[model samples]
Target: MSEKPVRLAVCVVTYQEPFAHSAVCKSLAGLPQELLAHLSVVSVCNAAHGTIADDPVIEEHQAGALSYREVLRSDNRGLAGGYNAGLQIALDEAPDAALFLNADGWVEAWYLTWLLDGLRRQPDREAFVPTLISGARCVSPFRKRGIALNFYIIGWLCLRDGPFLRQLRFPDEFWLDGIDYWLSVKMAEAGLRIERTERCIAHNLSVSDQFGTLPGWRYRNILVSERRFLRWQKRPFREILVVHVRALARCLRYRRFDLAQVVAKEFAVALHE
Candidate 1:
């Protein structure tokens, strides 16, 4: 009789950057063949200009590969929607665990091992997030003490057997920002523990050339997302306004009027309405 394989799934969402896609493929290629044997990866390409049906880099990786699935989206569904789409496919595979990896990020050889060990050891933990490092330094907000980070950039490693999975579903309403925060909050609300591993995963923080550089819209979306999170958390409007005002004051005091002006304007409007 053959032993049952320990099933695992990796989910990734991608845009139009071929280089980022290549980087992700390279990172996956670095994993051990034995580990790869029990794993499946689902990649979703969310490009507005039509999906990439095939890429030479991914084809090279898939050449003789034992475990993987690639899904190309015909239309761009934004980040949150793309991830959810990938997650749904991953869950359908009925893997013991599912990990979300960014196409722009790279993982160390033992990254999956560490995550799996964490989940195995702590049977109660619903999800585990690895520490995000840029080159040799940890760049994640969780790196610092007392820092209230609102996002999980390294993506999430979720255990399938936990009640958290059944209790929580990603909100499709959020266009981008605050999705991770809302998920984490929902997991906590369900009494499922969320843990962070000390292992560092490398994340490439490069902006896409094709996306064109526009900081204004990005900042505006962030403010709108924060407001949505505050409302979801059931925070009073007055309290949310006060928090934004304080953030603006701090930014101004630090001589960051560029950021202060943005927060102040958004908060002023949100407060009034």
Candidate 2:
């Protein structure tokens, strides 16, 4: 008898570019046959405007070693919604793990192989994120507690509150990773063991705020998501103050007073639903 090779759902969420020419497809097209045998791609697309629906690449990928499935919708549901749609389908097959990738990005084949080995070594981990490399920086291996608490909110403030950030190319994912942050808080509350990984993925800032505009609508969603998390954690008044003060300062500094207002106006937006 032999041990079965690990099966992975290489899940991607996208709203732009043709499916065949996407970073995910280009990478998949280059993968070795044996590796491809152990993988399936779950593509959740929010753009039905000929992005994935009419592309021949999905059929092409299905015809080869890779098994492919996609959920297409015209309505925009943000990142986590798209991820859930694809991951749910992938999970039905009981894959060993699901690797989520930024759709506007690519990962090296060796890193994918390394990730599988790491997953095998630590089968109990609830998740494993490759070091996300974009430009000269990366987001990886932050302590679990650091993210689950007010740090993410604080970072969002500092980035927006910075006078020069508007002119710089800062990544706004600190707020965008709210889904993962809340999950970390739950794991922390449960006393679950936390783990980290070293492999890397390159998230090319193609369709997102590559130039750090820090749009007002983005802020509203970010703050509302954090507000929901804080309430769920039953955080005290002062801890909440630490975040609000910084946010208020950013509002004044940017003259984007609407951010402070819309966070409440759009409180109905669901981070998990």
Which prediction has the highest lDDT against the true structure?
1
- Winning candidate number (TM-score): 1
My TM-score estimates for the predictions, one after another, are: 0.74, 0.66
lDDT of 2 by residue, 1-273 (tens): 977888877667677444555666676767888788777777866665654434322332363455577666665565656665665566667677666666556556776676677666765554444455566666433442224332111110101111221122212333254665654454445444334445555454321323236667666656666666666667654544555666766666666666656543543343222
lDDT: worst 10-residue window of model 2: 153-162
Candidate 1 lDDT, 177-273, residue by residue in tens:
6666676555545655667777666664432221133365665666777778777767767667765776666565656567667787888778666
Clashing pairs in 1: none
What local distance difference test score does each model get? 0.62, 0.53
Clashing pairs in 2: none
